[model samples]
Target: MISKEIVVANKTGIHARPASMFVKTATQFKSNITVTKDGKTANGKSLITILSLQLVKGSNITISADGADAAEAVDTLIKMVESKFGEE
Candidate 1:
């Protein structure tokens, strides 16, 4: 498994549209992905699971991937969050 903790950069954090985008992108990889916020964790490929977390700006979470392309998955996702989901 590969994991990295990063702050939610989007001003609105992960919600609705951004959450959908995240879930969609996560599914592009064959790796098993999980995102954890606080004490809660969700399936990174499920939009419902992600949106239910209601993550907010400044929140810290860990993104992890395990499988064939774990390293690339983690790195790409880190870059996505750092992009603020285009809210930048």
Candidate 2:
């Protein structure tokens, strides 16, 4: 498994739109993905699971992936978060 911690950068953090985008991105890879925050972990491919975390601006979370594309999946997710989900 591969993992990296990132801070939510978007103004609204991972709300509806962003959360949808994140879940979509996660499904693009074949790896098993999970996101954890403050001792809570959620399935990255599930909208309800992700939204339940209540990740907001400045919140810290660790994203991890396991599978053949683990590294790529983890890197892509980190980039997405660092890019503020392209919302600027």
Most TM-score-accurate candidate: 2
Whole-model lDDT for model 2 versus the true structure?
A: 0.95
lDDT on C-alpha atoms for all candidate structures: 0.89, 0.95
Error of 2 at 64 (Å): 0.2
Q: How do all models score by TM-score?
A: 0.95, 0.96
Please give the distance, in angstroms, between residue 79's alpha carbon in candidate 2 and its true position after superposition: 0.7
- For residue 45, model 2's alpha carbon misses the true position, in angstroms, by 0.4
Q: What is the lDDT, from 0 to 100, of the residue 27 in candidate 2?
A: 100
Q: Please provide, for model 2 over 1-88, each residue's C-alpha lDDT reduced to its tens digit, 9 standing for 90 to 100.
A: 9999999989988998988989999999999999999999999999999999999999999999999999999999899899898888
**Clashing residue pairs for model 2:** none
Model 2 TM: 0.96
Off by over 4 Å in 1: none
Off by over 4 Å in 2: none
Q: Report each candidate's C-alpha RMSD, comma-separated, in the order given.
A: 0.8, 0.7
